[model samples]
Target: MGNEKDSLRAKLSPMSYHVTQENGTEPPFRNEYWDEERDGIYVDVISGKPLFSSLDKYDAGCGWPSFTKPIELEEIEELEDRSHLMVRTEVRSKKGEAHLGHVFNDGPKEAGGLRYCINSAALKFVSIEELEKEGYGQYKKLFS
Candidate 1:
């Protein structure tokens, strides 16, 4: 088994750890993927599971990384979050078992109005520059 702390650290940046593991969030527009435009997939920060696709990404202007939808329903798990005197769906990576963020019903109408507000710490963006070199050559066509 991998060390939970080390595994998370290796996959996530320092800020990500604080946000995801600590149930915190980065300030708006301070996250890594908030304005990222790359070709590869975003994986789980801990276990490296492919969770969201760039195709499903969008700018929600919410100060965090938001996606229209997940790549697959089975890739993630949703729990009813009742914290802070509000009801929300808490999303987590099923493979990594990491706290990703939340899902909300209010989003762009074209994308089904479902915003998958995620934590940058729970994700690792694979850029086009490093896709092939990182053994993600199969996803190269996504950029084209």
Candidate 2:
């Protein structure tokens, strides 16, 4: 386990390692993918598991990448978080066990009224053009 973790730590950037492994949070509006506007999908940085779709992404004004939904509900695992003197639902990647961020009831009502506020450091964006090459061809139809 130590060797695997060490290898993973070496593979990820300091911010990514901190967010996904140590459950750290990145500064809002200063992190990557916060304002990304493209047709693609996001996968877990640690395990490369499918997570969120760009089509569901929106600017929640929280300075993070917010999505109306995940690419697959089964891909995410939500837990009750009681930290920082508050109660919240923390979202994590099922496969990687990476700390994604949090979810809230405040979102576009028409979109199920849920907001998945995710950390950019925990995700790796796979653009539409690279979906097939990246072994995620099934998701290319999302852009069409």
Candidate 3:
């Protein structure tokens, strides 16, 4: 595997580091902002590329985390995952290249029936309060 840990640390916070770097999962239902109803973007832990938005978020009760769609389709890289004797779509960050999680076809009808079951470790939420400060001011209209 490529050693992208150093680069990931520079872009993300310690908590994010623990998850992405150490492959740790944030406690279920106890994440810092898992229930955040704010309108904003969620980016990759390493490359800071936008992945998903609050608008596509839904409660899947799968434990880790889930999103309906990516903020930008090209920002994610999907690969055929056959790790556990099962065929699955493995989701990864296009830039950070970290393994985010899997994609499922069982989602709400309103969301095209696709669910991006992600790992909280692989994401960093950009709230409205920090969007402008984090160099993502251009996306402010997403909330407006």
What are the per-residue Cα lDDT tens digits for candidate 1 across 66-138? 8988876798999998888999899988887778999999988887989999987688888767878867677
The TM-score measured for candidate 1 stands at 0.83
Which of the predicted structures, 2 or 3, would earn the higher lDDT when compared with the native? 2
Q: lDDT values of the candidates?
A: 0.81, 0.95, 0.79
> Residue 41: error of model 2 in Å?
0.2
Poorly placed runs, candidate 1 (over 4 Å): 1-12, 141-144
For model 3, residues 72-113, the per-residue Cα lDDT tens digits are 899998999777698989888878767777899998987699
Query: Sorted on TM-score, highest at the top, how do the candidates line up?
Result: 2, 1, 3
lDDT (tens digit, per residue) of candidate 2 on 10-99: 999999999999889999999989999988999999889999999999999999999999998999999999999999999999999899
Which is the better candidate, 1 or 2, if ranked by TM-score? Answer: 2
Which has the greatest lDDT?
A: 2
Q: Using Cα atoms with residue i matched to residue i, what is each candidate's TM-score against the true structure? A: 0.83, 0.98, 0.80
